[model samples]
Target: MRIAMIAAMAKNRVIGRDNKMPWHLPEDLRHFKAMTLSKPIVMGRKTFESIGRPLPGRHNIVISRNSQLSIEGVTCVTTFDEAMTMAGDCDELVVIGGGQLYQQLLPKADVLYLTLIDLDVDGDTVFPEWDDGSWQLQNSVTATNDKGLQYSFNTLFKKC
Candidate 1:
Protein backbone atom coordinates (compact mmCIF):
# COMPACT_ATOMS: atom_id res chain seq x y z
CA MET A 1 0.00 0.00 0.00
CA ARG A 2 1.14 3.52 -0.74
CA ILE A 3 1.19 5.78 2.30
CA ALA A 4 0.43 9.47 1.87
CA MET A 5 -0.07 12.42 4.20
CA ILE A 6 -2.76 15.06 3.61
CA ALA A 7 -2.43 18.19 5.68
CA ALA A 8 -2.61 21.97 5.63
CA MET A 9 0.14 23.64 7.58
CA ALA A 10 0.82 27.27 8.28
CA LYS A 11 3.93 29.10 7.10
CA ASN A 12 5.55 28.08 10.39
CA ARG A 13 4.29 24.48 10.04
CA VAL A 14 1.60 24.82 12.66
CA ILE A 15 -1.01 22.13 12.19
CA GLY A 16 -3.29 22.63 15.14
CA ARG A 17 -3.48 24.61 18.31
CA ASP A 18 -5.96 22.88 20.69
CA ASN A 19 -7.20 19.66 19.14
CA LYS A 20 -8.71 21.56 16.17
CA MET A 21 -7.70 22.77 12.77
CA PRO A 22 -6.57 26.39 12.76
CA TRP A 23 -8.29 27.37 9.53
CA HIS A 24 -11.51 26.78 7.60
CA LEU A 25 -11.22 26.69 3.85
CA PRO A 26 -14.09 25.17 1.94
CA GLU A 27 -12.12 24.48 -1.21
CA ASP A 28 -9.44 22.71 0.78
CA LEU A 29 -12.11 20.64 2.48
CA ARG A 30 -13.55 19.78 -0.91
CA HIS A 31 -10.10 18.73 -2.08
CA PHE A 32 -9.66 16.61 1.02
CA LYS A 33 -12.98 14.87 0.46
CA ALA A 34 -12.22 14.28 -3.17
CA MET A 35 -8.83 12.75 -2.42
CA THR A 36 -9.74 10.66 0.60
CA LEU A 37 -13.24 9.51 -0.23
CA SER A 38 -13.58 5.71 -0.22
CA LYS A 39 -9.96 5.29 0.93
CA PRO A 40 -8.56 4.03 4.22
CA ILE A 41 -7.38 6.94 6.33
CA VAL A 42 -5.03 6.43 9.28
CA MET A 43 -4.86 8.99 12.03
CA GLY A 44 -4.02 9.34 15.72
CA ARG A 45 -6.56 9.21 18.53
CA LYS A 46 -6.48 12.95 19.08
CA THR A 47 -7.15 13.69 15.43
CA PHE A 48 -10.12 11.38 15.48
CA GLU A 49 -11.42 12.99 18.62
CA SER A 50 -10.99 16.40 17.14
CA ILE A 51 -13.10 15.36 14.16
CA GLY A 52 -15.88 14.27 16.57
CA ARG A 53 -17.34 11.66 14.23
CA PRO A 54 -16.42 9.24 11.55
CA LEU A 55 -16.39 10.88 8.17
CA PRO A 56 -18.90 9.37 5.82
CA GLY A 57 -17.87 7.27 2.80
CA ARG A 58 -14.48 6.13 4.07
CA HIS A 59 -12.80 3.72 6.43
CA ASN A 60 -11.59 5.65 9.43
CA ILE A 61 -8.79 3.96 11.31
CA VAL A 62 -7.66 5.49 14.55
CA ILE A 63 -4.24 4.44 15.91
CA SER A 64 -3.84 4.30 19.63
CA ARG A 65 -2.28 2.13 22.33
CA ASN A 66 -5.54 1.86 24.24
CA SER A 67 -7.42 -1.18 23.05
CA GLN A 68 -10.33 -0.78 25.39
CA LEU A 69 -11.57 2.53 24.13
CA SER A 70 -13.76 2.42 21.07
CA ILE A 71 -15.74 4.81 18.89
CA GLU A 72 -18.77 3.83 16.91
CA GLY A 73 -18.51 3.92 13.12
CA VAL A 74 -14.73 3.81 13.32
CA THR A 75 -12.20 1.05 13.73
CA CYS A 76 -9.83 1.45 16.66
CA VAL A 77 -6.46 -0.18 16.26
CA THR A 78 -3.82 -0.39 18.93
CA THR A 79 -0.71 -0.39 16.80
CA PHE A 80 0.53 0.64 13.41
CA ASP A 81 1.06 -3.00 12.54
CA GLU A 82 -2.53 -3.82 13.35
CA ALA A 83 -3.74 -0.81 11.42
CA MET A 84 -1.80 -1.93 8.39
CA THR A 85 -3.11 -5.43 8.76
CA MET A 86 -6.67 -4.19 8.97
CA ALA A 87 -6.22 -2.05 5.90
CA GLY A 88 -5.36 -5.20 3.96
CA ASP A 89 -4.74 -4.62 0.26
CA CYS A 90 -5.71 -0.99 0.14
CA ASP A 91 -4.11 0.78 -2.82
CA GLU A 92 -3.35 3.78 -0.66
CA LEU A 93 -3.30 4.81 2.99
CA VAL A 94 -3.73 8.45 3.87
CA VAL A 95 -2.07 9.50 7.13
CA ILE A 96 -4.25 12.34 8.26
CA GLY A 97 -2.55 13.58 11.39
CA GLY A 98 -2.07 15.18 14.78
CA GLY A 99 1.68 15.82 15.01
CA GLN A 100 2.96 12.54 16.51
CA LEU A 101 1.22 10.49 13.84
CA TYR A 102 2.88 12.55 11.13
CA GLN A 103 6.32 12.09 12.68
CA GLN A 104 5.83 8.36 13.03
CA LEU A 105 4.51 7.75 9.50
CA LEU A 106 6.27 10.35 7.36
CA PRO A 107 9.39 8.25 6.99
CA LYS A 108 7.40 5.38 5.51
CA ALA A 109 5.21 7.50 3.28
CA ASP A 110 5.74 7.55 -0.48
CA VAL A 111 3.70 10.64 -1.31
CA LEU A 112 2.78 13.78 0.55
CA TYR A 113 -0.17 16.08 -0.24
CA LEU A 114 0.39 19.24 1.70
CA THR A 115 -1.82 22.35 1.58
CA LEU A 116 0.50 25.18 2.35
CA ILE A 117 -1.37 27.98 4.05
CA ASP A 118 0.16 31.43 4.24
CA LEU A 119 -0.46 32.19 7.91
CA ASP A 120 1.68 31.63 10.99
CA VAL A 121 0.06 30.91 14.29
CA ASP A 122 1.18 29.67 17.71
CA GLY A 123 0.59 25.99 18.11
CA ASP A 124 1.82 22.94 19.97
CA THR A 125 1.09 20.55 17.12
CA VAL A 126 3.42 21.10 14.22
CA PHE A 127 4.25 19.19 11.06
CA PRO A 128 7.55 17.33 10.98
CA GLU A 129 10.32 19.08 9.12
CA TRP A 130 10.88 17.65 5.67
CA ASP A 131 14.40 16.46 4.97
CA ASP A 132 15.78 17.91 1.76
CA GLY A 133 17.93 14.84 1.24
CA SER A 134 15.07 12.35 1.41
CA TRP A 135 12.12 13.93 -0.37
CA GLN A 136 11.76 15.97 -3.55
CA LEU A 137 8.93 18.18 -4.67
CA GLN A 138 6.84 16.82 -7.50
CA ASN A 139 4.00 19.28 -8.05
CA SER A 140 2.65 22.47 -6.57
CA VAL A 141 -0.62 24.17 -7.52
CA THR A 142 -1.70 27.37 -5.89
CA ALA A 143 -5.40 28.16 -5.56
CA THR A 144 -7.80 30.19 -3.50
CA ASN A 145 -10.29 28.39 -1.34
CA ASP A 146 -13.98 29.19 -1.22
CA LYS A 147 -13.29 31.55 1.65
CA GLY A 148 -10.75 33.30 -0.55
CA LEU A 149 -7.86 31.91 1.50
CA GLN A 150 -4.76 31.39 -0.58
CA TYR A 151 -3.17 27.95 -0.36
CA SER A 152 -0.86 25.74 -2.32
CA PHE A 153 -1.46 22.08 -2.96
CA ASN A 154 1.94 20.44 -3.10
CA THR A 155 2.95 16.86 -3.68
CA LEU A 156 6.32 15.35 -2.78
CA PHE A 157 7.80 12.03 -3.71
CA LYS A 158 10.37 10.32 -1.54
CA LYS A 159 13.87 10.00 -2.97
CA CYS A 160 14.84 6.43 -3.53
Candidate 2:
Protein backbone atom coordinates (compact mmCIF):
# COMPACT_ATOMS: atom_id res chain seq x y z
CA MET A 1 0.00 0.00 0.00
CA ARG A 2 1.12 3.55 -0.64
CA ILE A 3 1.69 5.66 2.48
CA ALA A 4 0.81 9.35 2.51
CA MET A 5 1.06 11.98 5.23
CA ILE A 6 -1.54 14.79 5.24
CA ALA A 7 -1.43 17.91 7.39
CA ALA A 8 -1.99 21.65 7.53
CA MET A 9 0.69 23.68 9.22
CA ALA A 10 1.43 27.33 9.76
CA LYS A 11 4.55 29.24 8.64
CA ASN A 12 6.19 28.23 11.91
CA ARG A 13 5.14 24.58 11.47
CA VAL A 14 2.67 24.73 14.32
CA ILE A 15 -0.17 22.22 13.79
CA GLY A 16 -2.07 22.35 17.05
CA ARG A 17 -2.44 24.11 20.37
CA ASP A 18 -4.22 22.87 23.48
CA ASN A 19 -5.23 19.70 21.61
CA LYS A 20 -7.00 21.68 18.88
CA MET A 21 -6.07 23.44 15.69
CA PRO A 22 -5.05 27.06 16.31
CA TRP A 23 -6.96 28.39 13.33
CA HIS A 24 -10.24 27.66 11.60
CA LEU A 25 -10.09 27.05 7.87
CA PRO A 26 -13.23 25.53 6.43
CA GLU A 27 -11.71 25.25 2.99
CA ASP A 28 -8.86 23.17 4.32
CA LEU A 29 -11.30 20.97 6.19
CA ARG A 30 -13.27 20.43 2.99
CA HIS A 31 -10.05 19.67 1.13
CA PHE A 32 -9.12 17.13 3.77
CA LYS A 33 -12.49 15.40 3.57
CA ALA A 34 -12.44 15.24 -0.19
CA MET A 35 -8.91 13.85 -0.35
CA THR A 36 -9.36 11.31 2.43
CA LEU A 37 -12.87 10.12 1.78
CA SER A 38 -13.03 6.35 1.20
CA LYS A 39 -9.34 5.97 2.09
CA PRO A 40 -8.01 4.21 5.12
CA ILE A 41 -6.83 6.90 7.52
CA VAL A 42 -4.44 6.13 10.33
CA MET A 43 -3.89 8.51 13.22
CA GLY A 44 -2.51 8.57 16.74
CA ARG A 45 -4.79 8.47 19.76
CA LYS A 46 -4.51 12.17 20.42
CA THR A 47 -5.40 13.00 16.83
CA PHE A 48 -8.44 10.75 17.05
CA GLU A 49 -9.50 12.34 20.32
CA SER A 50 -9.11 15.79 18.85
CA ILE A 51 -11.44 14.78 16.05
CA GLY A 52 -13.85 13.43 18.70
CA ARG A 53 -15.39 10.77 16.45
CA PRO A 54 -14.77 8.52 13.53
CA LEU A 55 -14.65 10.27 10.22
CA PRO A 56 -17.53 9.02 8.15
CA GLY A 57 -16.98 7.43 4.70
CA ARG A 58 -13.43 6.37 5.60
CA HIS A 59 -11.93 3.59 7.62
CA ASN A 60 -10.74 4.95 10.93
CA ILE A 61 -7.58 3.33 12.29
CA VAL A 62 -6.19 4.68 15.52
CA ILE A 63 -2.69 3.92 16.77
CA SER A 64 -2.07 3.94 20.46
CA ARG A 65 0.10 2.06 22.96
CA ASN A 66 -2.94 1.20 25.02
CA SER A 67 -3.91 -2.31 23.98
CA GLN A 68 -7.10 -2.31 26.00
CA LEU A 69 -8.55 0.87 24.60
CA SER A 70 -11.53 0.55 22.30
CA ILE A 71 -13.89 2.87 20.46
CA GLU A 72 -16.93 2.33 18.33
CA GLY A 73 -16.47 2.70 14.58
CA VAL A 74 -12.70 2.76 14.98
CA THR A 75 -9.96 0.19 14.89
CA CYS A 76 -7.34 0.49 17.60
CA VAL A 77 -3.80 -0.72 17.06
CA THR A 78 -0.76 -0.71 19.26
CA THR A 79 1.78 0.55 16.75
CA PHE A 80 2.15 2.26 13.38
CA ASP A 81 3.26 -1.01 11.82
CA GLU A 82 0.15 -2.74 13.06
CA ALA A 83 -2.03 0.07 11.76
CA MET A 84 -0.53 -0.29 8.29
CA THR A 85 -1.01 -4.02 8.39
CA MET A 86 -4.65 -3.59 9.27
CA ALA A 87 -5.25 -1.27 6.33
CA GLY A 88 -5.37 -4.41 4.16
CA ASP A 89 -5.79 -4.02 0.38
CA CYS A 90 -6.24 -0.27 0.27
CA ASP A 91 -4.14 1.41 -2.39
CA GLU A 92 -3.34 4.35 -0.14
CA LEU A 93 -3.19 4.91 3.58
CA VAL A 94 -3.29 8.52 4.71
CA VAL A 95 -1.45 9.17 7.96
CA ILE A 96 -3.34 11.88 9.79
CA GLY A 97 -1.50 13.42 12.69
CA GLY A 98 -0.88 15.00 16.09
CA GLY A 99 2.88 15.55 15.55
CA GLN A 100 4.63 12.42 16.84
CA LEU A 101 2.85 10.28 14.23
CA TYR A 102 4.02 12.64 11.51
CA GLN A 103 7.57 12.45 12.82
CA GLN A 104 7.50 8.67 12.92
CA LEU A 105 5.92 8.23 9.49
CA LEU A 106 7.73 10.93 7.52
CA PRO A 107 10.57 8.65 6.44
CA LYS A 108 8.11 6.02 5.20
CA ALA A 109 5.68 8.33 3.44
CA ASP A 110 5.61 8.19 -0.34
CA VAL A 111 3.68 11.44 -0.71
CA LEU A 112 2.78 14.47 1.33
CA TYR A 113 -0.43 16.49 1.05
CA LEU A 114 0.38 19.67 2.91
CA THR A 115 -1.59 22.86 3.35
CA LEU A 116 0.78 25.73 4.04
CA ILE A 117 -1.06 28.36 6.04
CA ASP A 118 0.49 31.82 5.86
CA LEU A 119 0.68 32.75 9.49
CA ASP A 120 2.83 32.21 12.53
CA VAL A 121 0.85 31.17 15.57
CA ASP A 122 1.95 29.94 18.98
CA GLY A 123 1.37 26.25 19.51
CA ASP A 124 2.75 23.32 21.44
CA THR A 125 2.57 20.80 18.60
CA VAL A 126 4.54 21.15 15.41
CA PHE A 127 4.86 19.32 12.13
CA PRO A 128 8.21 17.55 11.91
CA GLU A 129 10.88 19.29 9.91
CA TRP A 130 11.56 17.60 6.57
CA ASP A 131 14.22 18.11 3.95
CA ASP A 132 12.89 19.86 0.85
CA GLY A 133 15.57 18.07 -1.17
CA SER A 134 13.93 14.74 -0.44
CA TRP A 135 10.57 15.73 -1.87
CA GLN A 136 9.71 17.01 -5.33
CA LEU A 137 6.84 19.40 -5.58
CA GLN A 138 4.10 18.01 -7.79
CA ASN A 139 1.47 20.73 -7.59
CA SER A 140 0.26 23.71 -5.60
CA VAL A 141 -2.91 25.81 -5.48
CA THR A 142 -3.18 29.02 -3.55
CA ALA A 143 -6.40 29.98 -1.80
CA THR A 144 -7.76 32.53 0.62
CA ASN A 145 -10.21 31.84 3.40
CA ASP A 146 -13.16 34.00 4.28
CA LYS A 147 -11.33 35.35 7.31
CA GLY A 148 -8.50 36.56 5.07
CA LEU A 149 -6.14 33.70 5.84
CA GLN A 150 -4.06 32.72 2.83
CA TYR A 151 -2.95 29.15 2.31
CA SER A 152 -1.75 26.81 -0.38
CA PHE A 153 -2.49 23.19 -1.03
CA ASN A 154 0.72 21.41 -1.92
CA THR A 155 1.39 17.94 -3.16
CA LEU A 156 4.93 16.55 -2.99
CA PHE A 157 6.27 13.22 -4.05
CA LYS A 158 9.24 11.50 -2.43
CA LYS A 159 12.12 11.88 -4.84
CA CYS A 160 13.42 8.68 -6.33
Best by TM-score: 2
lDDT of 1 at 83: 83
Model 2 per-residue lDDT tens digits across residues 53-76: 999999999999899999999999
Model 1, 1-160: lDDT tens digits are 8889999899999999899888887777888998899999989999998998999998999998898978998889988788888888889989899799999888889999999998888888999998878988999999876666778988998989
Clashing pairs in 1: none
TM-score of 1: 0.95
Candidate 2 to truth, TM: 0.98
Which residue pairs does candidate 2 place in steric collision? none
Instruction: Output the lDDT of residue 125, model 2.
Output: 97
Quantify how close model 1 is to the true structure by its C-alpha RMSD in Å.
1.3
lDDT of each: 0.89, 0.95
Q: What is the lDDT of residue 98 in candidate 2?
A: 75
